[model samples]
Target: MTAAPAGRPRTARWLLRLHRPALIVWACLVVALAALLLALRGPLTDAAAEGWRQYNACQGRGRCTYDQDAILRYKDFAGYANLALNALPVLVAAWAGAALIGRELESGTARLAWTQSTSPARWLTLRLALPAAAVTVGTGLLCRLHRLAWAAGDGRIDTAKRWYDLLTFNAGGPTVAALALAGLAAGTLAALLLRRTLPALIAGAVATLGIAGAAALLMPRLWPAVTLTSALDEDYPNVDGLVVDQGLVSATGARLPIPDCDTGAGCSAAYDRAVGYFTTYHPVSHYWPLQLTTTALLLAVTGLLAAGSFLALRRLTGPLRTAGAAAGTPSTDTLAGAAA
Candidate 1:
């Protein structure tokens, strides 16, 4: 009994040792990204804001004077940072599917571990738990730093992405962190199901993208969107935000599609019957509602995937296999034929 407890810790240590390279890579990624975000939140933001201010002041003065290079530099780095942050889910999924689970199973390493004092269930549990902890901490910190960087640019830099911009939105909140967790779970599940590194890696990455796409489709619907109506002559909503639905509203209050043609004769004919335009959108105030709701959805999916992985692992190894291995008996693969 005492040995069992000791063996569990050893399993964790063994996992860390096996994936030390991955740990180093992940740590370096987190540190580098954090530093980039801090730079964005401070110097880049200040420089860009100052450039905007100078440019605005020189407007209509004939010869414009501003630190254009600073603004361009901020724009370039912000795009890079957001891209990297958003790519975390797919990257994590590939790693988890190929290296964390599938490779071990494919190369017989997992079976060797299962035959030891650490049971298969405990082995799988540790595999999931330790990595999940690391993933959560790394992603959570990145999300916070990204959010701070984004907030620093908001209302300051003229070209800053709005809170509702898809890349910026996900990177700035808990949604991306939850998505990363879902990716890890999906990858683990895929590895267990496929039991092959290449197939699992592909399946995991595709599953994570599917999850992200679903979240995007469901996002606007998660919270009640506010509707704003404006005359056809006025700009839609008069604010920058996520527009759920926008169309012309008829005189009788029925919603209709926007005129197919741009301004002039055809558009005038199409819009003649309409009184004004109406927009259903999530304003800046709805950012948290949308983010939190999406995060919750992703987390729920992650839990389901993790649970499925456990169930799949159980089926792959069979019930008595681990017990037999624990009893110092030769462990026979009950589904050896199936595995082959």
Candidate 2:
């Protein structure tokens, strides 16, 4: 048999060829999402902001009215786009498990290729590498576009999403890219472990969802939070910051929930003076720190999963090597074992 190409580019090409339909779908999805974001940044946001301006200016008149339709349209489109961006990683995970790995293994295509000219290790590497590169590039581009669109509406559109909003936080930073890569790794591992398309697809999507949920829960704790203390009568400062916790602190040093006080009427004056409001939050400045920390964590998980995939492939191919040797057909694994 003719010798297989030595570099990764050839293997990458083969992997891409096998998954060309997925590649096309992913490309189209990215383009459509990006277009929507761009439209939101320019036309949709401008229309909403103009409506807000008209409404604010009409105050004190007999009746106040503005372009309610424009505002509603902007809100609906923005929400849909945000949902798409947040769900992109899960889609990647599902496709990776069902098409990229699970289908190949279930149909014996992977084993056939392994026995032909490719080592199991090489095949696994190419599988992971190609998808990883595509996911990174696609997700990274979307993240950058999302950040730009989000920033453009800051202080301009009243209905714009907040920095600390769940979907906004994940899409407007590196977290989306990290999550996408994590999904790819997770899906590959699930496919390898289950060796069935439907089961692996379900398991991979569920795993990705769990990881994303856990990350969202842990995000605020990744960095130290700043505490702001204020008199009970006064409102908490930094309303724009991401608030992790807010409660009342008693003079006796016990933390308590804020009392149901009606404009300083419900609670006793003594209690009001004794208890102050304490807020723990991460300011906007902490965005990079939080994003980088989470990205590091997700990349570490991806590395572990990749290592496990290669190890599992090695073990699975060992018996195949023995069978091939007894049949007098030198398997790719046997050739590599002998060379080593």
Candidate 3:
């Protein structure tokens, strides 16, 4: 068999190294999560049903049963259960980000990989794309599955599904994807700036989260997308002070009862004083636009992060001695492992 060209093979080798250490480990963990999530489906279904029953029982006595918003809050449990019970794909992704180019530079391996047939661009692309693609697919697939369950539970396709229904829900939202891309970008940026694995890892985590907050805080300001309002229209008169129009929630919740809600008084002899409250109000949202903008922004973040990583990789340099360089540490190990 003919030997492969120096370029493709060398670049492939670097990527394979990266994947073996990070992306492959991420894939394996995702498989494990998918299995676990599947395994518990029966219990979760039962729980949801039981929870519903518990709620209604409370209502019979005119008591608030489950917190109306618990449905939304509990969704995070899916992601929590996923991580608390098993390995987390995000942590693994973070670890991988911490390591990526940093470990290689730390161990002086990038020099070896780059010295061979791999040109800077090919080397960087291979190094970055394969592992990241794996991360995206692994996380994205799991998120897609999680959303499947959630969408089935809720009638409409939820655009900003909470982080916990499954970490995967976060995958669908623009902010989370942007944050994720920021994570990878932060890693590559750290790789370029720090060279040492440990510092890069720490810096990457802090920077990514910081960027996420700032982006969430500031980006929408510039983008200024039309926000959605979440009020239910009932038969209540539109008298201003008679009802308080609530601002939209950042997440979704099960329908709440207004004293005279749903334009009917089945709940109370007073024609559902609860019914009247909501009767005059309805939860309004533009599902179509919310979903479209969210999807667009998320895709944009993915592109930007990829572009950032590509640019960072193009500028990568070999490791240099830091001030008072120490040989090894636990943090360093965390940043250098295959799981990283």
Candidate 4:
């Protein structure tokens, strides 16, 4: 068929032409979120930090005053933005399943395309590659912006997000990008398996949620936790650290619930000296290790899903090719008939 025009430009153009609406929506969302993050990093964070400084300096001065409105506004925007970023994977999965692949399969457009100069494998590749690139770039940019916005308020604003918080952990690192890719792959897989729009969309979103939920539950255990044991009278070390578990430990090495003891003389005297507090936590240094490990696991899942999609495509096309050969013409109409 004249060598199919030599490059993937035509295929990419076709894919973009088919999915222009989704692409535009994604672009607008990215731009909006990025603008919000930029504002957070600059004006919002500054206002909140200034308010905190004022409040801290004026504490117990009887006439303390600060811009409470600015703090509230900053916190509101930060929280909403974080929520949107964390939900990006579900959005990607929905679009990938409902529009990208399922619609094509349901409407017979994919089969028609295969009847043209394209093979089922190439069609599936274009379906996945274009969306993967777009999702990766968009999500990766958002991750960087989120990290910048989050770090801008760190140590300055008292209510800034902690590293271990769910939204913060996913949004501020490579984990979001990895999740996006995984969602795309999952959606594509669901679309191929279902071959129907609505069912595929629901299945894809559910699959994405399952993957993200599991990752959230297992992330803390991926690395060895650091344990810090200290005398109950002494303050716990690294109070700002991401504490996974903390409890009181007896001299016999048995863990126990922390006693309701305060710093008062009576409480301290009643507390047993042999009962110390032990905190198992992830220090700030473990951030990259956790992020990278989770990202790797997600990317591995994406690869497996992509491979499965290709294999599914081959299985789908094998009988059509056989039928076309049997007809001796092996033309578009013959293959299209076989697909039908």
**Residue 274 alpha-carbon offset, candidate 1, angstroms:** 3.2
lDDT tens digits by residue: candidate 1, 171-285: 9999999999999999999999999999999999999999999999999999999999998788776756798998898889999887778558878876888888899988899
Model 3 / residue 123 / CA error / Å:
1.7
The clash number for model 1 is 0
Checking candidate 1 for backbone clashes, the offending pairs are none
Give the lDDT ranking, best first.
1, 4, 2, 3
Highest TM-score scorer: 1
Q: Which sequence of candidate numbers ranks them by TM-score, best first?
A: 1, 2, 4, 3
Provide the TM-score for each candidate, comma-separated.
Answer: 0.91, 0.86, 0.58, 0.85
lDDT, candidate 4, equals 0.84
For model 3, residues 209-318, the per-residue Cα lDDT tens digits are: 66545543433233223322323344433432112232222123322443343555543433322222332221123222333454465456556756766566544532
TM-score of 1: 0.91
lDDT (Cα) of model 2: 0.81
Q: What C-alpha lDDT values do all the predictions have?
A: 0.89, 0.81, 0.49, 0.84
Q: Candidate 2: worst 10 consecutive residues by lDDT? A: 319-328
Backbone clash numbers for all candidates listed: 0, 0, 32, 0
Query: Model 4 misses residue 65 by how many Å?
Result: 2.8
Higher-TM-score candidate of 2 and 3: 2
lDDT of 1 at 111: 78
- RMSD versus native structure for model 2: 4.9
